[model samples]
Target: MAEPQPYESALDAIPGAHPYPRSSRYHDAEVGIHTQPDGTAVRYVKRRLLPPLGEADEDIATHTVSSGERPDHLGQRCFGDPAAWWRIADANPVLDPRELTAEPGEEIALPDGFPGGGGRFGR
Candidate 1:
């Protein structure tokens, strides 16, 4: 396993300020502060580049989308946590997760190593 990268937050200098939660997709993304001409500070998250599908390694799994199945539902059915939908998103090429199941019978790739395994899709 690759060593976990250190997380640095622009808000870290502020007392009691915390970065995005671990469950958030942007949790590992960097935050930047831009100072406007009016002397106002605007904080924004840096663009996050999606990891290549190969990053999931050789343990990839597949899921067939069913009617009314959403990313969160797939996350819950595969990883036992609705918030883990991002993991599925990371494994696929969809820019918007909702499109992952917009068409029934569509197949999407799932990364391994998550809880609950990636076999069931709540069918």
Candidate 2:
């Protein structure tokens, strides 16, 4: 087998290597952050496949909420239905469907199934 190449630094191992931001808004030492000219920041988090704390594995979900998008829009994008707002509501326990609103740059959990249809619904 060929010899493994030594990483120059921790950042080199990452797929997209970019300089850390000066603001340190989302910098986690373990994970790197990338800043955009539009004043938006993107965080690169690292997690192992296996459970980190206990024997049971955990499900960690991440999402970026953009401006002018309601829960219904996200449901439609993920599950292909605007009426399936419950998916978004359920994912975001802090949110109220009656007055749904998502802040830009806010990350939220995406529902498993919203517009529950496709394979089963067709048949």
Q: Which candidate tops TM-score?
A: 1
Clashes of 1: 0
Looking at model 2, which ten-residue stretch has the lowest summed lDDT?
A: 114-123
On lDDT, the candidate that comes out on top is 1
On residues 16-50, what C-alpha lDDT tens digit does candidate 2 reach at each position? 56334311212323674788999889876654121
TM per candidate comes to 0.69, 0.39
Candidate 2 ranges with C-alpha deviation above 4 Å:
1-60, 98-100, 113-123
Tens digits of per-residue lDDT, candidate 1, 1-123, equal: 232355433455455465665546776688999999999999999998776666656677777888988888888887678988888887788889898889999888887743223444443
- Separately for all candidates shown, the number of backbone clashes (residues 3 or more apart, or on different chains) is 0, 0
